[model samples]
Target: MSAENEVRQFIVAADDDGIRLDRWFKRHLEDVSFNIVSRWARTGQLRVDGARATPGDRLVQGQTIRVPPAEPVKPDTVKVKPDRPPLSDDQIAFMREMVIHQDASAIVLNKPPGLATQGGTKTHEHIDGLLDALQFDLEGRPKLVHRLDKDTSGALLIARTSRAAAFFSKSFSGRTAKKIYWALVMGVPEIEDGIIDLPLAKQPGTGGEKMHVDEKEGAPSRTRYRVIEAAGNKTAWVELQPFTGRTHQLRVHMAAIGHPIVGDGKYGLQEAFLTGGISRKMHLHARRIRIDHPDGGKLDATAELPSHFAESMKTLGFDLSLGDWIPLDDGPVPPTREQKKAMGRAHAKSVRKERRGERGRRRG
Candidate 1:
């Protein structure tokens, strides 16, 4: 430990009362690794309420925890490097062109479809790797506060500073941030406007890439949707507002309700692709986001539909003018913290039940 570093004490917040000790460390002291936490616990260096604590030990509200000083990691010991090479001139220019809004606190990009927000296996090009191009002459590199799917095009927010990033992150995780999406589904829903309250879980055996509707073992997911226009029940332009963020929540929810977004092969199946000269790109777009800004006023931005989505709308005879209209009222109020906790508990119970069932099946 460096001379500047000292032992730190923390009081468990009400919101984190029942969370595991290791999870608490990950949330508050993100730089501390699980290995370090484990080592400390084994060596009696970590304590809660003046006693040794375990990684899985649940913390209580107002409990006192003593955290030891973290040793500064030497530069030579760092192993991981930037995943991809620096952006080329053309890549830089392309990124610059995507900027729809930029200010001291944030930058909003009209992210195009077919572009991944961050890189993964087999993914070379992504917004994260190309963000250097957006720097211009700014002092600090911009950071992504949220993410959209690879095929989802639209308003992607990038925080300009670390403070701004932390602020936006809190806003999002606290459910104060509001996002609206525009998607063209293959079939028109029977109801013009309604809410989908479906629980979502990773599909078994998918290696965590795909989501499925699993009421028994899934997290609470809700989406409010209104149909803007429909072409004789064949296809509809729908506006979606997700109340709870989940992996592929909108896509899986729509598909679970029997109206998958067009061109979504992973969730929707073959019928999702429209024939007859319509572009076979996913039609989901993150249309708008409204949130409290770090600098006092509201931060809001809207992204125009990608060219393919626009063409599809025109072909389906849906009016494009409706996209400009913002909802008169703040959409749905986010759930209370207690309600969120209850939902989380239900999901965890379901997961445990599922694991037991799987074990029984294996034994049989």
Candidate 2:
């Protein structure tokens, strides 16, 4: 986080779940201090649904809040600079180019891991704030149709106008958007492929700064995953397609099944995030996407996994790529013939055991 005074943005999480306004911002905002948050609200720096709100106001879900910056004491005299350049021209240029496809209606961006899709007061240099650097015609201010976790790189759609935003929002709300993620979980699935249908309600942490799984009252979430490449000794290259998008749903769900994506801070093995294990980045990527285009058709987008991810893939014994799509007839390159054969053998044994048990019951 540099000392730049960049314009910030934030998303209001609804209060229906009983989250407090001040508390929420304190947790969500980066570079934002608690005292500053309080003063901003007192001075009407906070707005709810475009209206001012009190610090104690209970959050209503689905409301958007905006917190304006504080007036500088020595407005013109003080400029905060960072110790080091936050993002280089080459990096910014790289980011702009990652935007694979954009139209007057929508933008398909390959978001890098470690960058927030949107922004908050504490958030500096996020994808939302960098849109101006892009060489596209965003008819007006573009809004993120969805988000990827800071450490997860992948394709995300941005609506360029309010109308387009509304269109994308509706599509997401209706569960028509198809999102695919690639996770380098540190274990193989019990089955070759399966769907995890579990409800996820966010469980608050002791410090109220982290999240966990609470199945008793969790929201409905589902994920379909297949082992694309087995990296041996409890690790695999898995392709995940989430049906219901819950925050950290994919990561948590994978962990629940005895597999967690390597380098996932909250829901993963600590060894994977340590200095020696993985350099500095997480091993989760939003690989490809298929969504309804605002203009009439489908938009397919892909993002090559970042350098850190590619390196991990090599170390983990997975030389896969998000290259051109793999066709059905395409032979065993990733989940090669030997691996498929082994899985088939395992499945056949399970089926044979089940049939024998059924016969024994009939004989009895």
Clashes of each: 0, 12
* lDDT (10s digit) by residue, model 2, range 134-243: 53554355667788877788788887765566567777887777667877777677796777776676576445334466667767677788888886655788888777
Candidates in order: C-alpha RMSD to true structure: 10.6, 13.7
Identify the runs in model 2 with alpha carbons over 4 angstroms from their true place.
1-94, 206-209, 271-280, 321-364
Give the Cα error of residue 215 in candidate 2, in Å. Answer: 2.6
User: Against the true structure, whose lDDT is highest?
Assistant: 1
Location of the lowest summed lDDT over 10 successive residues in candidate 1: 328-337
Predictions in order: lDDT: 0.87, 0.70
Residues 1-364 of candidate 1 have per-residue lDDT tens digits of: 5544888899987646566899888778877889999999999989999999999998887999988887687787666745657678899899989999888888999999999999999998899989888777677778899999999999999988666776788788888898999998988899988878888899999999999988788888888889888888678888999888999999999999999999998999997888877898999999988889878998889898899988988887778887657482375565644577999999999999999999999999
Candidate 1 lDDT (Cα, 0 to 1):
0.87
Q: Given candidate 2, what's the lDDT at residue 189?
A: 79
Clashes of 2: 12
